[model samples]
Target: MFYDVRRIESYSLKISIENGRVEKVKFDESRGKAFRVLKNGFWGYFVGDVDDREGIYLAEKNAIGKGDVNVLNVSSGGKFTLKPKEDFRDVSVEEKVEFLRDVEKNLKGDKIVSTSVTYFENVRRFSYYDSNGNEVFYEIPRIGLIVSAVAKDRTLQFYSKRIMKPAGLEALKGAYDIANEVVDVVTKLVNANAPPSGDMNVVADSSLAGVFIHEAFGHAVEGDHVLQGASVLANKLGQKVADESVNIYDDPTLREFGFYPFDDEGVKAEKRTIVENGILKDFLHSRETALKFNSKAGNSRAEGLKFPIVRMSNTYLDRGQYKFDELLEIAKDGVYLVGSRGGETNPATGYFQFNAQYGYLIEGGELTEMIRDVSLSGYTLEILKNIKIGCELEFDPGFCGKVDQLVPVSDGSPHILIKALVGGS
Candidate 1:
């Protein structure tokens, strides 16, 4: 095993528009350095970064430490190349603002009293080096579009969604529709009634399905939590954990939100099956954690300048043969939940809570009435087992938070029929 020193420089533009007016514009540039040392067992780690070359050397020298050091022998070392459909560098900032303004304008509706649109683009360049005389350089471009709509009435409701991908200007092509969707949902909720809390089967739309995977399953598989003995999955390998129809994966090689050619540890990224047909196929692992279990899967990632830890990229459930209507056919007296605002998970306890932007009540297998203020809470294993059916796959982009840091991620599946224990918390 060998150690590598890597540096990354990122440039980003964040533009926000509210109520059909440009509210703020900001540009940010930052550089980060990381040192990868392989000496002791999996327990040894010391990482810190500074801007100057002198500080880089100081950080490297200080990276040395005692205890177990986990070293992974990667097949190759380099950065992944990104091909943008539309280059942000080739587009002017004026065009970006105009695009968002257009979206806000279209969001006007009787119930939608206010609308906000946010546009973000970033270029991340990586320079990598290793003790084995290897060096590489590459850049990845990312873009995101988010819109939020609020209903004005005696009762207030808000709806929002985010789009993330590797494309540039063309990425905003569907942003207009996102605004419309938010408006449509919020409009319904503005006059909708509260959902009756119960343990009913729910049909989660693609976005909410993504949240179910990210918050309910992704958090449960993080290797660090397992290493800290804080994960329910810590010692449950090769066990049956879900229904026979369920399978989940994390593949950064996918050109979606969480796509990365190489992980922060200079290891090439690949797809790994975390669960298959209710079986615990594997757990996400960093080099250190992988060594601890004598495994070879690589899922290590570092946020900006932090030390590498296990994280998921493009984490999602595989598609099933059933169509969405089939799920509706089964959830006749349940709820059709859509989109996600945010959620939380306790990997150690296997508990999760996710909030839905809006929902529609289903009666006798037909859409009935709109409902608001819906949140789902339950244990991860129980929910997974309760997944009776899922439609063909779909995807949604998002940012995942961990250890006080956020990283780009995407998750999705078709409408899933989960006999979830939901409530209005």
Candidate 2:
């Protein structure tokens, strides 16, 4: 048998604060060892927590007979570079904590009944090799700061707009913007009222619209789901999916949370268009799925130590021809939904549910009353076709969860004016 080896390691630190007291601090490191041994087109895989060279080799040899030895048909991978401005390895935990503490203190306000803040930092290093002599190596650092706020009512709440980014400590510097947004939303919620129910022309803020595209449309474009006959977009390539002004992309090549030199499968990632000028372009794919569907692998990925799966990195809508105010100017009576509290979707059924932190009634093309508990639910295909206009673009960062696994992702679009259906009690 011939074997190929890969090296993987992760360093992580987390600090949580609540009620002006230090809550918890966690530090850990993980090193993974894996061997790819091939015999007669069959692959024998072995993975463990040990890093000793001898242990890794022995584990590969010993596991040859335990599981199904099926060789994975993979694509050719080559050298690539994803440079970091500052590496997390050069920073200390105490330094990270001090920055987070400052954020907590800065956000403390009279209307802020309580505050909880969390800081997370991680660095991943890995290298992989193939029998074909292809090699890929990567070093990436990520940082996250999340602040949760409660108003005097205790029930009125919201979360920070800042999410983890694929950068170093410098990424955490401008977090006061997020903290201020959270404070504003929570305070408004304490005094806001529910929007009156009606058929409405709506403007979805960039962050909320980004979540709409990701949870509602992006997942529908993963090739695996299409192959499984579980996606609403299945077999819809070359057809119109939205307004001619709508152009959505999954571009890992762009600088965002999902950027990577190469996917976990060691394949070079590429920018892909899922929708262009209202037409369906293509679906995201891994090598196997791409082969099965006669397409290119768009670098759909998963975490290390696990086999790679089809996933989106930085999915976003391209900016449109209109500005945000212009969209509102066209709608005399409507509501504008802003920000997001995440959302849920069934890509197969095209059904989705998304909650906005707050909304404002627009009267005479001007912002008016504030509304609370705004949730939008509908079929993905139906609502997308109803998009009247697209606004300029912006990004909202967060973690995307799939099958209980969390991966960093960013979603955004400019404000979108839509004739949408929303419901709440």
Highest-lDDT candidate? 1
Report the poorest 10 consecutive residues by lDDT, candidate 2.
63-72
Model 2 agreement with the true structure over 313-398: per-residue lDDT tens digits: 99998988777788889877889998887678999989988888789999999989888788877788887787765656788887
Tens-digit lDDT string for candidate 1 (253-316): 8878988887776677789889989898788888767877777656877777777678889988
lDDT of candidate model 1 versus the reference: 0.79
Residue-level lDDT for 159 in candidate 1? 78
Segments of candidate 1 deviating more than 4 angstroms: 38-57, 63-65
Task: For each candidate in the order shown, give its overall lDDT on alpha carbons.
Answer: 0.79, 0.77
Candidate 2 deviant stretches above 4 angstroms: 1-5, 35-45, 49-87
Between which residue pairs do clashes occur in model 1? 40-69, 41-68, 41-69, 41-70
Instruction: Using TM-score, give the best candidate's number.
Output: 1
Q: Which 10-residue window in model 1 sums to the lowest lDDT? A: 39-48
